[model samples]
Every structure is written in structure tokens, then in C-alpha cells.
Target: MMLEYLPLAVVAIVGVPLALAALTRRGDRALTRLALALFDGWVADRGRRQRERRELLYEVHLEDTYRMYASKTLLYAGLVALAGSVVGVYLAAGVLALFKISPETVRATLPQQLWFLADLLVFPDLSLGELFTLLAFSSATLGVAGGAITYWIRWENLSYRANARARQIDESIARTVAFFYALSRSGMAFPEIMRSLARNRSVYGETAEEVAVAVKSMDYAGLDMLSAIERLADRTPSQKFREFTDNLASVLQSGQSIPAYLDDQYERYREDAEAEQEAFLELLATLAEAYVSVFVVAPLLFITILVIMGLMAIGRTLPLLRVIAYFAVPLANVGFIIYLDSITESLRATREAREIDAAPGLLAGVRRTDDPDADRTGTERPAVEGSAVRSDGGERPAADSSAGLAFERLAAFERVRWLRDLLSNPARTLRENPVYVLYATVPLGVLSVVLRAWPHLVAGTLTVETLDDFVVQAALVVVGSFAVVQELHRRRIDAIEAAVPDFLDRLASVNEAGMSIVESLERVADTELGALDAEVERLRTDMAWGVEARTALYRLEDRIDAPVITRVTTLLGNAMHASSDLARVLRIAADEAQDTRRLKRKRRQEMVTYVVIIYLAFVVFLVIIGSLNSILIPSLPTGAAAPDTGGAISGGPLAGISEVDVEAYTLLFFHTALVQALFSGLVAGQMGETSVKNGAKHAAVMLAIAYAVFLLLP
Candidate 1:
């Protein structure tokens, strides 16, 4: 009877929350307070600290983000469970009806035994209605339990994300501290350095966001810089960041030299970072060994064993082999790859932007008086001012309209700039937006496939084999296009990266010789810096034509699109504002860039062997699969020869292959080889290069090799 009301019970469970919300609309704050009080009471002190760390790591407010998500998660999880319970009860009823499970028959079989148990529990004899009620209650209980478990899992996931964020922040702290040190050496105040760090969050990642939090407290919450640092120190998830902040606060309080403190911190962190890198490299080596043992050797062993079993016509050998080939090997490889990615994911080169900590009137105190044509100081003029007022007070375009005219030209240039870019630097354009390759590749590929499959389509009888051929051709076109484009793009970026350290060093030397940055840029722009010469020339041109030094530098950064350049630009731009003695800052940036380049070189050189191993492993896998399809399968006796007398062959006993489909096994081998080649190439690329995008070229190469081997060798 209770099961019949399952739908109504579920509706009531859902409606209660909506009704409560509607009724408490005017008392929302009270309800929120009540919820917080409940959660606060339930949370122990240790859990509270963890929650605080989670909140600070994610930069979420307690009142808004934390309480709201927690409340919503609980409410929604409960609702889901309630719905599950209703469904469970309804399912129970339907199942009982379908199976004709009569409670009377159950009782009749063991009435005395059941009644004795019921009497001991102080209940009357069990009936069908009571049984239904018990089942419904159990279903509801399970639903509620499931909901609670789900909420716990989600909460744990948030903690994991916070930990990841903390790791990234910790990784980048040394570089970030160096940036602060350099700016401090240039005579910028600590607060100003913090603000600069905040502004360049895109370049520095999570560490910058942490700095921005303090900047916000100082600027908006009326806290002194030292007090803000203290608050940040208390709340940050990273022990390293917390230590840095605590030391910074101590320096501020004790009146130690800020630059000296910063420099010491930078050097200390740099050493620690190097130590961490060595540890990381050691871990990667271990992972490589494990990947070989688990993904390569184990899979090979399994395949060999399964094949041998198949040759003897052992129990369901083909099905087991298929499971190993199609599921086990791939899944294990995927798991290994994910584990590699997780461990290698760095805090130092973290890619995402955090929430911006905006403080009102942040730049109100800064005064800019350098421009002669400006009617007012410290006010930004638009890139394009309404040309000029003629003597008759009418608007007309100015011939020498400074950068406003350049802005106008850009407005016009926007229409067909992509076409020009595509024609001129197609590789770079494709690299910046890889999806563009798909636009051309997808259409051409589809057309090629259509052309190839036209006859089959026209006859309206395309076999699976024909479809597979079309897919293979189309996939080759797509992957091949991406591979070609990405490889070229990678080469271009490598050339640019090679030139950056030298570029910065020379610019620093020139600036140190008493020339302004603009003058140094002009002097060095004409120097042959290989890949960087044209970019330097463009920087000079932008400044000469009345563009702000910062604007011109940023434009150069935009054109180059390398993280190293972005960091250098941000450092130089911010440092140039703090003092004219920017040579030291430039030198520091150059050193950091060199360090980054060295690390990349080291990683590539070390991982190259693993990449080679992957290729070799794939080759081995291909050889074995190829041998099976060509030699063993064909050599097997087939089709009704006295139940194919189990024979001894090649020093091993072989069972008659009575029912095995040679074609099916051959097709499976063909597909497995193709799949292995594709994934192995990807793994090789990822192991060699940090990016999976780099794997596309490897995939293409491997796929081509697979195609050649299967077609010619077979």
C-alpha cells in the first residue's frame, strides 16, 4: 500500500523545499543564518581549518560561496536520494508483481519461525501491506544514504582541486619571488610590487592571485599592508606561500631591508626549486620504467599468452583475447597516461587565470605627465580621437593624427587582416588557432571520402569495409593536417625562444649604458638577432610613432605569443614604472628565461629515450600481431578433418581449430594494430613533449607505418 503512494511521497519530498523557500522569501537572511549555524555547529575545529584552507585556496567568500554551495549540495543530494527512493519502491512493487512474490506463501512455509521472530521483536504477524511498508522504508533509507555519500564525494573533489591549485602556486613561487625581488631592487615599494604582481596574474598564475588578495585587503578593506600579509599568511593553503608571507610580514615589522629579504627569499626558493626539479625528474624516470613494465611488457605478455591459448583452441580464447586487446590494454594505457599527466602537471607553468581581485580606484593616485599634446595629465586618450576639429569647427581626418590614425587604419585592417595573416604566416596563424586547420581539413577530407565512396553510395550498398576505408582516409587527412601545422608552429616557437635570452641580455646591456629603454630598443632593433630582429624593429616603430613604451612592448609580446616574452614584458613594463635603472631587472628576467630554456632542454633530452622506447614497443606489438595474422592463423587446420586431430607443431602441442573464424581474428588484429599505433604515437609525443598536441605528428607517423605494414606485409 505504501509502495502505491511512492510517487506522492517523492513529490512531497521535493515540494517541501520549494514551499519552505517561498514561505521564507522575506526571511532569507534568517534562514541562511540558521543553515550556517547548523553547519558551523556540526563542523569540528579541525574540519573548520580545512574548510578555511579550501575557501582561501579557491578564493571564495565564506558567506557567499562556501555556505551556499554546501547548502545547495546537501539539499540537492537529499532531493536526488528521495527521488531514488520513490523509484526504488516503485521498482520493488513492479518486480514483486512480475515475479508474483506472495507474502502469505512466504509466511505459510515458515509461519511459526517467522511469527516467533516477530513476537520476539514485539510485532504482530507479517502481512503483505506490512512487507510493502518495510520494503518502501528500506528503499527510502538507501536513497538517503546514497545522497549523503554523493555529497561527501563532491566535497572531497573540491578539496582535491584546492590541493592542485596549491601545488601550482607552490611551483611558481620562486619565479614570482624573483620578480618581486627585481622590482623591489628597482625601488618599488612592497605594496606596489604586490599590485604589479596582481596586475600580471595571467603571467604568474596562482601566486599572483594570492598576492592580489593582500592587495585587496590593503586597498579596499582598510588594512595596512603588514596586517593584510598576516591575514594572507594565516589563510593560504600552501605552507611555502604561508611561510613566505609570514617572513614578509616579519621583515615589514622589523624594518629589515625589503630588497635584501626579497633577494634572500628568491635565492632560497630557487635552490629549493632546483631540488624539486631533480626530485621530479627522478619520479619521471621511475614512471617511465613503470609505464614500460605495465603498459608495454605486460600487455605483450597477455597478448602472447592469449594467442597461444587460441592456437590450442582453449576455453573461449578469442573472446578473452578480444577483451585484452580491445579493453584491458587500452584502459591500462590510458590510466598510465593520466597518472603521468597528473604527476607532471606543474604549479610553475600553470595555465589558468584565477578570479581577479579588483579594488576600486586602484590607479587613482598615479599621475602621468609625459604627453605634451594631452589637455590634461593622467587621463587616457582613446586610441582614436575624433580626428581633429577644423578651423570652421567641423571634424576632419588628421594627416599626422599620431596613433589615432593608426587606430583608424587598424579598424579598417580588421576586416581582411585574417586573410593577410593566413597568406603571410599561415603556420603561425594555424598554431595560434589549431581549430582553423579543421575548417580546411574537414571539408577536404569529407570531399575526398565522398569522392572515394561515390560509387558505393550511388549503388546504395556500402559495406562496412567500404565505410572503414572512407573513415581511414578522412582520419588520415585530418590528423596529417594537424600534425604538419603543429610541427611547423612548434619549430617557429622554438626559434623565437632560442633568441629571447640574448634579446633580453643585449637590451639590458644597452639600457645599462645610460640609454632609455626606447633608445636601447632603437639601437638594438637594427642588430641581427635572427628570429627576433623583425620583432624588435616593430617595437621601435611603435614607440617612434607616439605609442606608449608599455603599449609598444605589450604589442611586441602579443605578436610573439610566448610565455617567456609575456613574463619579460610584464616585468619590464612594471619595473620601468618604478625606476629608470631597469638594467638589473632586465638581467634578472634574462636569467629566468635562460633557466626556463635549460629546463625545457633537459626535460626533452631525458624523455627522448622514453619516446624511443614507445616507438620500439609499438614496433614489437605490430610484429607479433602481424606474425599471428600471417603465419599462425593460416597454419591452423580448418574445416572437418576428423575433428582436426590435435597435433604437435613446432615443438608445441596444438589443438584443432574447428570453429575459429580466421577472417574475424585477422580483422581484429588489423584493427588492434591500428589502434595501438595511434595511441602509442600519442604517448610518445606526450612523453617527449609536455603537450599532447605535439603527439599529433607522432600519431600521423605511426598511423602511416601501421597502414603500410598491414597492407604490404600481410
Candidate 2:
């Protein structure tokens, strides 16, 4: 009965739209205006509600909500909706036509085909008009659903953007508070400082935006700097920001020394930041280990078990196992990869948050004060006062401070320090520089290659066919030698850099004591008490062998490339040609070197999180690959194979290749090994704080592990 009336229904639906268009020809403008106003009010109300909730829940400031969609966005959205509706209608009509036309033929030739077509279209066996009616209903339903989903997502995105803006405002307030505190300490008037902040808002990032607002408030509303700051803080969503502003307000009201308070706060911020970084690093290390176990060890173990089981059950193997191993394995591995990436990104975000939270301290450290030298008075004063006496006397030498002490306290456990340094050396460099050890290992590589290929050679089958095996085996040995040599060189460089700083400081001190720079270098070289002493002695030898002092120092700089060494050398070389204040120059150089060292330490701390993440990612990659090979791939039917080549090679040396497509399998194994090596090396290089060459060792290790496992697998 419904089918008989479908044509009439379709006509009525088409007629109604035309009828409505005829009646509302001239009122579209008024209707559109009214609709837009309502929409605007609705959005504003929603925003207000959201702001209220955010304020209540997180102590956020409620900024005025503005309409997110501009006319352009609305126009684009309308265009997209219209296009989607047209596409949807066309598709529905096509599907309905297919269903209606194919029913008789499909039912006659293949009943299942009819059912499949019916399932897809949701209806079948209808006239053209009836099909049109069904198409109209289905297309409208789908188009509306899609449009609504898209709108909802866009709306949610707008809200998220608003929240982010609010957070940015809060961050700005916090930074401004810090800046004002710094300026106030430096004796800048409150109002003048606010103006300065306004002028340089761009430099402050998001914090500058709040400072701009404060400046505007003062200029336009007749509010003082303090009152404007209080208002800004009140409107900010950050609790830390609010607290900082409140403290600033109190300090301003009391007229206390802003500098002293800022200094104290800066130190506190540094300590807190350091603590957060330390925690993040600790978590990162744990994560790295977890990833290694899950990705590397677990996969290897599972693959090993699967291979063993498959080998043992060769005669009884089911076809389904191959399907599972190939298809299932790859898919599962892909899924695990996605999961690992998501986890890594999440952890990275958390780490970044921790870093950002520590920004106050970073800003404090950068803030310059007029009396910058005052903070260093305690340490610098003694050096300054004693300089003249030491310079004139040239007898009572500067005492070796505790800072000069090198390698005190040997381990009770019999020197594990060397072992630590060895492990800490970049692994990739060690692999790439295998030539350093090639002289020692060339014979061994030849032997391993010969021994491994002995069977084929002994059978008078030693031809080009077997050469690849020998070459591969020998290459591995060569690679191993390169790794060992690189390790040796890295250890030497680390020892030199570690000792260069204090050595330079001592040299500077000796130079300050009226000793010629050359004599100072000789004196430190003669001490023969530390790693730097040895390096200096090497320099002295070069000098004794007719090398100029400047040239020898330059050579040392080239070898070590330590920034401290470079700066000190540059200073000494310049002072040698100038009749300037050598003592002051040396002092300044030492201080700069110390600062560089401090910065380096901070950078290392920051990188620790990234290092851990890279390692974790590698581990996850390994686990996923392992799961694929061990479980998924083996389960697939396509992967299943017979043990023999149907007696084609029942009694030849080529039997192994015949029984399996050994060439293909070997190629696949090699490819996998190479990729694993490349990425593993990259991760190891990043983690080990060494060059990419250092990463080669990690790549080699992973490659070796992978190849061994694959070879051992049945």
C-alpha cells in the first residue's frame, strides 16, 4: 500500500519547496537578520555559561565572550552544507536506481547478490517515482546528520580556542608580575615601569598582552599602575599569576626593596624549575626502560617462541597459521605503533608543561639589574683586593682552590668510573670509526668469514654464489672494529672537556699572579696532576719542539674544541698583543666560562626528557614489529608453506634454498635489519648525547640482534 502511494509522496515533497519559495520572495532579508540575531544571542549566552563554569571550577577570570564565526566562516559553512547535500542526494538516487533496476536480474541469477544490493540501499523492487521518494528521505537524513556533526565539532573547537586564549591571558599576567617586580627592584617608578612594559609588550609574549591591558587601564580609566595590576590579576585564570600580582601589590604598598624580594623569588623559582626537570627526567628514564622491554625484548622472545613452535610442527602446520602471522601480525603491529605514538606525544606534552611551569625561574635568570656585579661581590671581592699584592710579589702564588681539585675519592668498588664513561660514550661514533681498531681485528674478521663459510668451501662449492655470505660476515666484523675505535676516541675527548674548564680557570689565576701567559701554561703543564695537565704537557711539548705559544694553544683548541678553551685562548692571544689589563681580562674570561658551563648543564637537563622519549619510541617500534612477526604474520594463510620443494633438491648443497625461498626470506630479513639499525642508531645517538655517528653503534646492536633472531627462527 505504501509503495503504491510513493509516487504521490515524492511529488508532494518536491511541490512544497517551490510553493514556499513563491510565498516568501521578498522577506528573506528580514528573516535572515532575525535568525542571525537569535544565533548571536544564543552563542553569547553559551559562552557566558562556559565562562562562569570555568571561573567556578578553576578560578579563571571571565573575559567577555565574543562571537567566534565571522561572516566568511558562516558563508563557507553554508557552501559546504549545500555541496554536501547535493552530493548526498546524487549518491542516494544512484543507489536507489541500482536497487530498483537490479532486483529482477539479481534475483534470477544470484539471490545473494540481490540481498547484498538490498542491504546496501536499505530498500529494493520499487518504481522510478518510489525510488525518488526513498532517495529524498535517505539523502535528507544523512545530510542533516553530517551537517549537525560538523557544526558541533566546530562549536567545540571555538570553545577550546576561547579557553586557550583565557589561559594565555593568565600566563601574561604572571609574566608581567615578574617583570614589574624586576623593574621595581631596579628603581624604576611604578607608572613609568608600566609604560615601559607596554612599549615592549612584544618581547614578553602572552604576558605582554596583559601588560597592554594594564597600560590601557591606567591611561584611559585614570587607574594607577597598582590598581590596574590588581584588576588584571583578578581577571586572569592562573592562580600563580593572581598570587604573584597580590604579592606585588603588597610590596608596592609597603615600599620595600623590590630587588631583594625579586632576587629571593627568582632563586625559589629556579629551585622549583630544577626540581620539576629532575622529576621529568626520572619519569623519562623509567619510560625508556619500559619501552625497551615492551618493544625489543618482548618481540624478540615472542618471535623466537613462534619460530621454534612452527619449526617443530612443520608436518602438522595449519594453513590458518600463515594467515594469522602475515595479515594479523602487520595489522596488530600497526595498531600498536599508533598506540605508542599517542602515548609518546602525551608524555611529551606533560614534559613541556613541566618546563613551561618552570618559566618564571628562567625569566628571573635573564632579568638584568643595574647592580649586576653586586651579587658576585663576595667571591669577586677577595680576588680583586688580593690581585695587586699577588701581582707585585710574584712569589706568594695564588693557592689552588677546592675548585681546582681533580678526581678526589676513588670508588670502594674498584673504579667503576671508567666503565660508566665507556657506556656513556656515544655508541654510533664507535661504530662508524671501526677503522681505528681494524688493524687489531682484520685477521679475526677474515677468520670468522672463513669459518662460517667453511662447509660450502670444503665441498668444492666455493664460488661467487657463496661469496655474499663471506662478505656479510666480514662486514659485520669491520663494523664492530669501527665501533670499538670510536668508543676509545670519545672517552678521550670527554676526559679532556671535563678537565678543560678548571684547567682554564687555574691558568687564568696563574696569569693574574703576574706570570706571563706562557709561563702560566708551562706551570699548569708541569703540575702533571690531572687530565688537563697531561693535555697541557702535550701542548708544552709542541712548544718545546719550536711551535709558538699561540700556535700550540690554537692546536690544543682545535683538538678539544671546548668553548672554555677557545675563549681563554682567544683572550690570551689578544692580551699577548695588547698592553691592556690582563688580570681583569682573565677574571672576566673565567666568569664567562663558568656561565657557559652552567648553561650547558641546564641544556642537558632539558634534553633529558626528549632523550627518554626517543628511546621509548624505539622500544615501542621493536615490540610492534616483534608482535607482527611472531603472532600475526604466522597466523595468516598466505604465510603458510610446505617444508620441502617437492624433492627438487633432495640431495644437494642448495637444499636449504630449495626447501624455502631462501633468497626472498634473506632479502626481507636484511631489509628489516637495516631499517632497525638506522632508527636504533638515531635514538641511541640522541640519548647518549653524542653525534649521529655515535648512533651507529645502537643501529649495529639492533641489527645484529634482529639478524640473529631471524636466522635462528625456523
Best by TM-score: 1
Taking the tens digit of each residue's C-alpha lDDT, what string does model 2 give over 1-714? 787555445645544543453378444334344336645554443567556544433232223223423221243345345545655676776665656544456545433323565435446467888877776777676667665666666455655654555555443342344455445543556676666555443334445555667788999999987898888777655555567667877887798877566656644544554464466456546655654565445644554554344433332122333444345444544454444343222111010010000002111111111332111011121121222345566654453343122112221222464356446764533332444366556778888778877887789878643665576557666665566566666566556556655776677678768787667778877664465766687777766665556556655664454445654554444344433225544554455455445544664565566555654555555455555455654543322353545554443322332233333333443444445454545445544442544555655665566556555544
TM-scores of all predicted structures: 0.77, 0.41
Off by over 4 Å in 1: 1-70, 76-145, 294-409, 424-435, 640-657
**Model 1: which residue pairs collide?**
168-347
lDDT of 1 by residue, 1-714 (tens): 887686866668665654575487644455455556556454343576656645653543233455555655566566668776767676766655544534455445433335443323333445898877877786887687778887787576667766776887888898899899899989998888888788667678778878888888999999998899999887677889989989889999999898889888888987888787777777777777777777777777787778776667544577877887788878876776776677655522421232111111322222233334211134332335457777899876644455445445544765577799999998668876676898999889888888888888899988766776687768887999888888877787778888999988998999999998888889888888988877788777766666667656756766765778878877887887788888989888988888788877888898888888888887888888888889987776655543433444322334336567777777777777777777777777767776667888888888888877877865
Query: Every model's Cα RMSD, please?
Result: 9.2, 18.3
Question: At residue 171, what lDDT does model 1 achieve?
Answer: 82
Q: Rate the local accuracy (lDDT) of all candidates.
A: 0.72, 0.51
TM-score, structure 1 vs. true: 0.77
